[model samples]
Structure formats: structure tokens, C-alpha cells
Target: MNYDQLMFNINAYKENNQILDLAKFLVYEFELDHPNLEGFGFRDELEKNSILLTANGDIGERQMVLIPRNLFDFEFNLVINMIAHEMLHVRQKSPEMMLEDKNEREWQAYYEMLFHTNFPNVPDVSDYHKKFFAEKALEYYRRMGEGSELQAKYADQKLKVLSLIDNIQHNQA
Candidate 1:
């Protein structure tokens, strides 16, 4: 589907006037440079608990991102965060860069997200959210099976991302 259709779905899922406004704000925030980029919406049953941002190949071709509808049920800020995070991934795809450095790639995306958005100033991330991400990563690993090296790679990347988030929060404090 197109970006507008995807946005409509997200807006429909929003629960309140404040959330609608937040969603609008996020859309405006993303639109500042988003028109030049190529993006499409795809349903991700597997990633129902998480959002993903991926860029394939150089020349900045093949940009794809998915956001979970369930996340919209949590907080409007989260929806904005997920979308913004994925947009950063779209920006990171370089034709010259090798794809093997998964952790490095994720670190770059996380840094981009932090740099682009006004992340909340909370010193410590809630245990609930931490456990949620951990569990989501574990579930992904299980689905990928032990034979898949990608699963292990993702796990390592996830750990690094979590650590980076912690560092950002600590530094902010």
C-alpha cells in the first residue's frame, strides 16, 4: 500500500484527540524531507510487536518499512518514534557499504532516530518496555531457528541497541 493509506490506518487507530494531534505532528515532522524518498507500506504479521526499517542496495533503492498497529494502542509518541526510527533506516542504505555489519547498521539507525527526534527525558526506561523489546527479540530468534545465523546476528544487534539506549538515557540525566 501507499504511505497515505498507511497513515490513514494509523490515524484510525488513534484513540483520542491528543493522539490524533500527535499523529499529525509526527506526519508533519516526517514530511519535511520524506517526499523525495521512496517508501511503501507492507503488512507485517511477524513483526506485530515491533517496527522495522530496512534499506536494500545502494543508489538508495528499495526502501521498506513496517510499523505495528498494536504499538499505536500504547502511546502516540511511540507510533511517532517507530516511524521516525524506520525513516532513519531508509536514510542509512548506502550502495558502497557492506551489509554484514548488522550491529553497526542498527547503531547508526538508533543514533539517527535519537538525533532526529525529541526523545523523552526519562532517566530509566520502564521495565515493561525493556521486557517487551527483549521478548520480541527472543520471539524473532525462535522463529528464525538455531540454524539461521541471521537470528544470532539480530540478537547481538538488539543487545547493542539496548545498550546504546541506556547510554543515551544516562547521558541525558
Candidate 2:
């Protein structure tokens, strides 16, 4: 994932009809915006950021999505997932309101991450990080939505998912 190769992929995405296909993928399946993502650039690597959308210009309802090339190593399925995440942000008419509810926002992200990870195909990706990517996060979200204790539910679910994965991964290791 050098700089040149990253640009190559971005260019290839356009030339090979991949960009259009990915844009359609969002529209058809996720009800997300079909982005006109042009090019990526180098930006300060905030430790927590893997990918983010910085708007360059407006094209009707959508803006040109500028990415950070060095932030992530490019993989086809993974890159699609990353773009999909940002598309979620773009689709939000009031992202500031969404951001106000920390639990709901994280719950939605984690809930969606499970789909992107393809738990069956890459189960091990979350084996040691169940709290971040497992059913427990979803369960916590559900309980919190039910008017239960927030922090307690989160704590309980995080450890629960981790423990569940530990049990499942034990002998197979």
C-alpha cells in the first residue's frame, strides 16, 4: 500500500467502472449517496482516524469526497466498507444531532460493522475484540433502547461478547 499504488487503485476504480459500481452499491443496497469520489491526499494522521470525508466541492446534493490515501491500506472489500461508512455520514442531513447521542451513534456503527466484516468469512477479525465488533455491542444497544441502564448495559455486554468469543475460539486455537 504505497502512495503510488494507492493512487493507482483510485484511478483504476474510475477507469474500470468500479467507482460507479461502488456508488451504485451504496444506493441500491444501503440507500446511501452515490458519491463522486475523485482523489485522495495526505493529511495529518489523527491516531483514531482511518478514513474521513473532506468535502471539496458541491455537486447538487452530494459533495466530492476527498480521502486520505495513507490512512489505510487498500483492500477491495475493505475499501468498499470504508467508503460505505463515510457515505453514512454524507447521508445524514443532521450529523450534529446524530453525534449528540454517543450511544446510538456507536451502536449503529458497530451494528453495521458486523455486516461489513462478514462475521462468517472473517470471524477471527473480532475474536479478541468482541466488545468492539460482536453481538454484545448490538445487545447493549438493544437493552439501552429498552430504557435500561446505559453504562451498566454497555459494560455487561462488552465483557459478555468478549467472553463468548473466548469460549468459541478456545479449543479451535
Candidate 3:
């Protein structure tokens, strides 16, 4: 996908300010560390979907955060939580790390919503949502074990990328 095009479209929407403000708040509250974050944006089409965030490795290290622009119209905190969750994925190195990080982020987001905030009105998520997330995590782990041709091609690439990230972190220390 064209990162610039997506960014432009998102910025063109006037309601994007609310989402951006929520994102800024999350960055501050979570103390998230990101290097390049110029490519994140909210899209209208993703509304009504459970998928809150998605990252495109081919799109200049950018990510797209989707919120139910309508249902979440009153729940801005949830939108911020979703953005933070996706940011964690962008910071991941290995496929193993990606899966682990995403799971942890989801839990963190849910915990914050349930305990940290004082909404005093939000209901607990349905059992279906809980089951779906668990199943998704299992599917991700299964992919790591599969020996498909695509997996074979990317296994070495993933290792190289992870090693480079580790080396950079070591150098910083």
C-alpha cells in the first residue's frame, strides 16, 4: 500500500483530530519508545471491525490503526489503547517476539480499560472476543511451526532482521 496516500487520506478527515489527540495521550501515559512514527493513521473503512491495528512492513516502517469511528465515537480511551497496542508490534524484532508482544499488549490494553480508567459504565467483553483472541494467538504459534515454502523463504530473513535489531540494542547499551 502507498503509505503517503494513506497518510494523506487520513489527514484529510476532520474527525482525525480526536483520534490523534488520543494517540498522543497514549504515547505519554505509556511512555512508549518509537523511532519513526510518521506513518500511523486512522481509517474510516476499518470501523465496525474488531481489528484495531495493522502494520505494513513494506510501507516504510509505518502502521495503520483502525477504530470503529462510530461505535468508538464516545469511547476515545479505547481508541488510544488500540494505538498503543499496535505500536508494540512495530517495535518487535523476531516473529516470536512479535507474537509475544502483541499478546501482552492486548492484555495491557484490556487491563487498563477495566482498571485504570474511571468510565464506570463499560461492560466486560463478550466471551466470543476472549475466545477469538486466544485462537488467533494459537494460530500465530502454529504458523511458526509450519514448514511451508513461504515460511522457509522468510525464516532466514526474520532471523537476520532480529539479529540486526539485537545488535543495535546491544550497541546502544
> Using lDDT as the measure, which candidate wins?
1
Task: Report, for every candidate in turn, its global Cα lDDT versus the true structure.
Answer: 0.48, 0.47, 0.45
* TM of each candidate vs. truth: 0.44, 0.42, 0.44
Order the candidate numbers by lDDT, best to worst. Answer: 1, 2, 3
Query: Any runs in candidate 1 off by more than 4 Å, and if so which?
Result: 1-27, 30-32, 47-59, 69-71, 94-100, 113-173
- Cα lDDT of candidate 1 equals 0.48
Cα lDDT tens digits for candidate 3, 1-173: 35466345445443565655545444554565365444446555554545446544533444444443442443334444455545655554223344343334444344333333322333334333433433443344345457755445445544443454455557657
Q: Worst lDDT window (10 residues) for model 1? A: 116-125
Angstrom error at residue 67, model 3: 5.2
- lDDT by residue (tens digit), candidate 2, 1-173: 45577456556656664644434443344344434433333445445535454534332344444555443344444555445555543433133333334455455455444444322222123343433456645654765666556645456545555576577578457
Taking the tens digit of each residue's C-alpha lDDT, what string does model 1 give over 1-173? 45677567666646553443443345554562243235434454455555443443343464545443344655444555556555555555534333444444454444434344333321233444444444444454455556566655566655655675576567667
For each of the candidates, the C-alpha root-mean-square deviation to the true structure, in angstroms, is 9.4, 8.5, 14.8
**Model 3 Cα displacement at 115 (Å)?**
14
Mind sharing the TM-score for model 1? Answer: 0.44
